[model samples]
Target: MNDKFELPPRRRLPDEIRQRMRTRVWEGLGEPDQRPRWTVTVRGRAPIAVAAAVVVLVAGGVTLLQSVQGGGGQPTAGGQATTTRPSQQLGPLLVPGVAQSAVDKCQAVAFAQTTPGDYAEPDRWRPRFSVSLPGREVAVFDAAGPVFCELTRTTVTVSPAVAAPQVLDVSAPASAARVTSLFQTANHTLAGTVDSQVTGLELGLANADGSNGVLGRAALMDGVFVANLPLSERGAAQGGRLLLSATTPTGTLTGSGPVPDGRVWQGTTVDVWPSGDSDPTSRRNQLDRCLDRALVNGLPGTDAEGWQPGARVGSAADQEGVLVAHRDDGQLVACALADQHGAELQLATRIFAPDRTANPDVPVTAVDLSWRFLTVWGAVGPRVARVELVGENTTATGEVVDGTFAVQLAGVTDAAGWETRNVLRAFDAAGNLLYEGTPVIRR
Candidate 1:
């Protein structure tokens, strides 16, 4: 016998609807193999309990399935069900200059911890950029349209390199600077200011033709700099300009301008006396005689016998004044206060033997050694004040008098094994090492 239960007036559902209902039933049962067989019943044809149970199962299954699938099986008012692409974590985006391995590692870590909704548009997500900082730290950024995420790690840091700044500022002098205009003088002083950042300043004297002479350099102190320059007399005669340049960590600045016309000193003579002295007139007369002697002997045309009065005679209180005179040939005659009264007068001149001369003709020509006394005689220069005899183990000193120098040499005696090498040196009134003579052998 056929034991089947069916409701009267059975209606056939569409194939698509039947498939959807089957899918819902399987989904509700959780396991497709565990789904129970269902018997359909028409309205008002079967027992109330059976018909009610069928209605409840079919309604709940259809509602749940439609919600899960976003109403896929049925059409909305728009005529078709809307769908969207599944959200996904995209592959690593490469950044220029960054290593590929680094990008891969960063992407792997970000994707593992990220969810689909973590990004508004997961499909559009990409690596935006990265920065490396100190202490082995790296920052990685991922962006999707307007949304972005920043990931930091302590593995590596890729800091961008920057260049140092080169900035400099310089101000030119308001007027030209001038030194002595005498044909033989070349000493001059220049002063200016530079930017605080500048560390050094160089001044170059160039001829009219643009050829540069010796350059003078000076260090900046609190942004101010001063340089003592010596210009070539020939270059000055031909006309030249001064070039000032300053250096900073970032760059260099340069400026050029005309220098003042150096004019010859036209003064004749200078007189100086003690500032607070008991006898002012006598002191003045003494200084006058001393200066007159220097001009007569030092100058070429001046007659030593016939005393001629100087044109300019100015006195100073401290006896620390400079005596400058101009000759007919434009040569400078300058004398500085050497020793005050009771002391010999001194003058400033380039007449002293040049430095590093082998035979400095210091007047001590012969050394007369004796058991009673020792005498050294020669025409010592007026600038020579004292002479010293230095040996390997002994020393002797002498005083300058009447263009001659003498020393006693008391303890030193002439002996066979006592032979030693000796050197004679001369010093000016100002205690400057004026001359170093050739070696003298003493036995």
Candidate 2:
């Protein structure tokens, strides 16, 4: 995601509004159209302005519409709607009047909820993202800087407080993003972005039978998407991780992501495979020999000779083992070992990676013992809640064990070019991407 892009705001316009405002946006032609003209141009395509004021909504990187022309007119594709005011560069995002009214009230609520020192000045709060429905079923939602407010014909609502930004992590967001102020919503609508290739969003909510079902969904729209969910507790007290599909492509891509509320649902971490050595004597003998060979190969840490067994990774055959030892700099030196003749062991291959037991980032390392076998392992930190290994021919999720994980893969015959063919990834509980790249290698 680009730093120039902001996070999705709160509230989803009703279905009737969605039906009236569907725009076709061609890929790679999408760019902000903000010029003073009698019309609006989106992605280099022009859309004519209506004779009357039409409601417009903009969030994420796209603009939404309530009406292309005046009330009852069909939606015009490829352009953002605006009030037909001459000499204006563009109309206010969403309906200016409704947005302002909601913002004013929301600001007061936020001010009351926020601690005195944390509150923003009134002028700093601006209506940057918004969406609305026109008529008696009005659902105008505006995210004015730190405050997220929603207005309907009968009631007005906002987030719980002026707090940190939170959203369902269907896709990676910009690093250290600032617009993460309002994620809480008093209404049932959840708003966020999905993978561009994703045509729809399906939420797996908990059922009474301890299973999950698609209780909510959002359709891809020209501007941004909004998910209408069944009304539940604002901060629903629940258990277990909800099924997450941050981005399942239009009949292709599928995956999990972060949830807006950390309480309701998050990534569930499975314990790593334990040191299941059916034969400790044989495993220790091999590990000791591997550590000695590691010393000869310039493995880090002054206590190489005293390095103890940290993990025993089983392989396809008894000839393979992994030697994991701590480096002096809090990193790890994992060496793949093989017995040449059973009297002693030889270091086949090695890797250097973070042993982030105390650090927040997920650690991953990969090494090929034999040209046909590869060993991958890492330590899971507090922030990491999920791990996946992907190759052109390989796909597997990592399980945790005492905060560490190790897995062995057979039939990789391309040691030198393995990284180019495989990818290892780790993610946070909300499906926010943590790491996505090749593991550190020490061949």
Candidate 3:
């Protein structure tokens, strides 16, 4: 009856499957005699049901371990290798924060790409300068006389020390130069001169350190060219002069004098006009508005000082005038005749305001004087502007729009009782646009 009644579902399993299942269940029990003492702990009973559950759990744990540490140990589509380094495997070198490191980087770049003859020799023409660093120096070499020296910095008790020591030029002729100058700031030397047989000149900066910078050769322009360079050490204008002789085709230039009044003219006589009340005294501020030069009084070989007061006055002579025009927006526009100067001339005046039309050609509007600086705006080349406003936050920049300038003047509030002298500007209806002159108040 037992054999014919048909075995239960468990008894009907294949023989190999049934044997394997039985082996798993037996392994889960405490194997007291096994080499490793492998065993499974059940909370309550040691039944076959619990033993089967333990076998399945152990198999799952073994599969997970194989997946992580076997051939599949490499990163998958959604996973990354845990052994990768973060920094060296990614990007640039780790930069140091030391000041010397920063300085070294700057020096490397400068030395690699710097143009030759940027630094001057010992005798370049430049202004005085003060040095405040260590390891600074200046080098000088004399082509003609026996001259070679180096200026070096040292530490003194109270203040820093800088000393000059003479040396010999061991390499070749002192680079044979017709002219040389010492730039004051860098103390470096500049060698070379204009190719002129008639004129020989040399200039030097009084104070320069070796390590500052180098100077370059002079730049010459044809004709009796003149340059009014502002002295870097002092706020003074130095007059650079060049004399052209009939025998010489060109000549060297030198800053020989200072100009108290700002007049550098090509021609002998100039026409000038002053703005505002057009006072004759203002027009003749410096001996008929003449800056000190070869044409001024008491110059060599010229008796311009001996000439009578009215000797050089001619009605047809050029008229240099300073013009002050008014605008509807309470601004003043000042323009100076570049080459004209005289006392008995009429100051040119124009009302520079916006034209009342659909296509308006706006003029520069200047603010009235009220003992304070005001915003003056003018157009530069139809679009850009020159601006002057007084405030800590005032800033001016240029803009181009539709072939006309868009001048933006900001941080200007109230201006009263301030007289702005030599104020040149242009503007549109929106606001003031450009300014060029140095604004000054009259005493």
Candidate 4:
């Protein structure tokens, strides 16, 4: 039988969809997975579930507030440009880096305007970064003139690969999350989910000392990235993807596949295979995608190349704890810290797409993994849009304990016209659902 699954048809999702989804999965779905199909006995389920719950509660509250201020309809001109009072500001979540003291040691300066008005108008020039840190910086954003940040660090005109350096004061969980969201993996040709959600974020990728030679990019909503998207000529193809490789000095990143929504950097199509082979037509070499500089709070880097791309990523968060997403193989992989104390993480979990009700049996389309968590995300088109979750434990020595489980399905809406519900799912290390709260979408 040609089995086909389908999501419940609807004309439009309500504004509160984002909020309801978050509340349902994150806030404590009340019970854990009854009989999880996957489990590593040593791994517990309590702490992980609790942590996931915390994140859901916080995100849900923010979404609700945004809905109220934004109205239950689409974003308006005012809401799009300048946020009103009691708005959801984006940044390191831990600190606001606009104080004069923050930019004390920077040699050069550049401003990336994210607001809606002209730079001359201070009101339109939203205050994203308050200072410039060592390797973190921004471009003046003059589109026509010299629109790049200044760097004090010396550049070694050697191979792009360099020893990993240190980045200052960027270790908070929020900081790490912001940085990850900023660096859009070229592998995924589509305009990143970042532009749609994050209003402004600063990334700092440089040595500890106030130096230069770091590369990074920031965004204001509906700017350059969005302007070039949903490729005009190139239709949607699931081949393009993004990969972060810390195993190398330069921390190589590879993007492959056709440009689905041709907009930004859409001319040359790129693709990378599972076996690490590339076609002659692929822009694997030309597009040396790397972080030049990043800004957060106020500290922005001027040197576009002084700091190695992965250094900040490594120092700030555990390198082995990488959240890998592969479009080629259609999977999400997370590696554990590969240190002496860290466990050997290589177990990959696979889930069905959200619309899997059509086919009760064959659900998984692709999968990949390294260590901490085995994640899988893909679409079954609108027909079979169900998502399934499965896990595995790949530990050698002692028992491995995995904690925390949370899932977010972006671009979803609710039935009533009150909120947008973005489906949220939480599972334990053993692949058990701890909480299942759905939150309403505000922005």
Candidate 5:
């Protein structure tokens, strides 16, 4: 963050809290992004959710209101630029910068013109940074941040972008995330930025058998990294999945997201293989779209507390998705569910939390939810080694990972008869019986 934008001593928030809020808002903007904006190596920050999103909307609203008033705005036909000088308004110029004539064209495009919606015309926009690449990237920014990205072949403009001083965060040292589509170039490629600590990078596609396939190392310069993608390697199925990774001293950080079409990122395709690798990372990675929704849409008060991604329990075309999310701390366990609407899994319904304890020797609480579907999922005791679903026409084992436990069930079973159709038996490592009971059928 630029320190020029920092609050005056009299108006400043606590340094720590203010930092967290800024991180959350910037990271939260990544609803469609596949990689995390911040790292979880230490796990101090919370994922941005509905609340942080509201902050962004509200900020935009403030800009709208200010713009409507006599506040500063871009130069209209006869209007003059704000008296605020240009140099104070931008970040550093990227190395191998574009020619001044192109920069002059960018300066002509008002900052307000670059962004969509009615925003107060910035005092002025200047070219904080300019990069000459196949993707002509220009940063038209005010101290607030990059106002908008001009990815076109020509342009130059600077705004009050880098006037602020920043407090360096030494604990985590670096943060990374996938760039949004607004700046995507025509060539099939993925783009991201990195700090000096990220010395090397590797990007690849998740394979059919849960192995990794190299897409080629990313090309980095001026804090930006762009990797050419093999278009043939990406498809609508299980094999061609591209994932994100950044290398640091501790270890390599990795992430997955929807496929990039050189235009827009595609939603992950999902499928289940109960008969396959017990559980494949590829299946879980694809189903992550469901888990990602938990960060943005999950509401504990509404019972949709699911977060971590897991293997898809059923077929992808059918559209239903299920994952058991165990909280980082071992106190509670819950299910995250998304239902089939058409060809894909829809935003998950709110009724997700089982809200039960999963301690040693505790009985696993099975709960049945969804009136339209017969879904049986619930808590798994920490010490319990296995949970088997017995009764019905056949016996099936729940996929238990860490403190989570979930199984796929056909909606063909009668909701009224689910309790009698299946019983859950949990056992410890010694195969000693922890407890057994029918599901707590939901309304």
Candidate 6:
């Protein structure tokens, strides 16, 4: 009876079919009791239950296969297929806190790339980070342009990108008009107020043909800047313009203009000496004695008493003598004696007041002296043509050159421990006294 009730034929399932069945079972669709059942009749065998069972198993396998293949797992919030990849694999999403972390990372990277000695400070730079919505790809970028670092869920890239520094404004020497003493060589002091943002300032003097020559640097103090740029003799002879440049982290700003021949004296005269109660004649006599002593000790033709009247001196028409001295208003007055052939003896004496109160119009600005030379700078009247330095032992004279008087002391010596007093005098073309002052010298 079992042989008579046997199935017509039995065939083994293919490997692909078996795998599909296993996949469906794993997907929770092919449960034993939930599978469908069917009835099948074979042609030669009695009403066979085996055929019906095989048909039922095949129908259940087909339904389970469709469920596994057609309906796959949904994606995760990070845009990654949950079925294929775990949620943790998709890197952390960019939250506000994460953005800050990215900024810190970028800053570290930037510091590593920069030289240690660079003046730029890392804290001064402001940083910004990119953001992304949930369930989307999250990426990390550098704080600034030329992105150096990029971080993703599964990859990281490093590339150099440099951003320009922040620019700052320069407010000093607002215009070419603020430059002072642009052309005057004697008092070459350039001063102006600069913007607080400026870090460096420089003054350049170039020829009109755009050739570079002299450069002066300025220092900023309490928002004020001052530069003393004394041009060389060659530089002054060549006409040029003044350029004022300011530098910041961002860029450089320049202000330029034609050099002007500024006035010798621009402001009111300052009195450098105070009034005193000394008599003029007494002071002059003392100075005369000092000169007589120097002449007797240093000169060859003079005796202890110095040149005197009726003495067998040189045959020149002008018999020189050290005359009596006096003092007027704390100033020293000494005479240079000149006995002409026919005219009476003339004493060419000049009064020297240390203070500028002697003549406000002609103010001494600078006085430079060495062992055997003297240079005087002043705003003497325009009519003055010669400047002289009268000392105890010798007289040094100089002509106006570029608004200054430089002279070499012919008879002076650099004897150590020997202190001497000298006076500066100015004269016009007619030998008329214009200005005189006692020059302060450091032995």
Best by lDDT: 2
Runs of candidate 3 exceeding 4 Å displacement: 1-353, 358-364, 367-371, 375-443
The best candidate in terms of TM-score: 5
Off by over 4 Å in 6: 1-186, 231-238, 271-443
lDDT, candidates in the order shown: 0.36, 0.41, 0.25, 0.24, 0.40, 0.36
Q: Write the per-residue lDDT of candidate 2 for residues 1-443, one digit (tens) a residue.
A: 56697767777666445434423331222322321112321111123232212222333233422232322122234433322221212211233334566566666655665566555566666555555422111122334333445443223445444444454432333321111213323234444444344544454443222233333344333323444433242123332223333343323333223234633321111111123443424544445434433332222222233434444464334645554544323334454544421122222112233445654575655454355556677565667777776767777665544445565666666646776676777788899888776764332
Question: Candidate 6 lDDT, tens digit per residue, 31-110?
Answer: 33444333222111122111011211242344311221111112223442211111122222223223555555545554
- The lDDT of model 6 is 0.36
Give the higher-lDDT candidate: 1 or 4. Answer: 1
Model 1 lDDT tens row, 88-131: 32212223233455555444444544554543343444444432
lDDT of 4 by residue, 311-349 (tens): 001111333222222232222222222221112122222
Q: Which ten residues in a row have the lowest lDDT in candidate 2?
A: 265-274
Candidate order, TM-score descending = 5, 2, 1, 6, 4, 3
* Model 3 per-residue lDDT tens digits across residues 1-443: 56667554543445456446545554454332331221221111121111111122222221111111212112234543222111122111112122332233323332343354432332332221121121222222222221212122110110001212112111212222222222222112111223344232222211111111112112222211111122232112222121111123243232222212222111111122222234434423322333211121111122112211111111122322233322322222232223343221111111233332643433333232212223333322343333333334554433332222222233333444223323334444457554343333211
> 2 or 3: which has the higher lDDT?
2
Q: How many residue pairs clash in each candidate?
A: 4, 10, 70, 102, 26, 13
6 Cα displacement, candidate 2 (Å) = 66
Tell me the lDDT of model 2 at 211.
30
Model 1 pairs whose backbones collide: 132-158, 166-250, 275-317, 363-378
The C-alpha TM-scores of every prediction are 0.23, 0.28, 0.18, 0.21, 0.33, 0.23
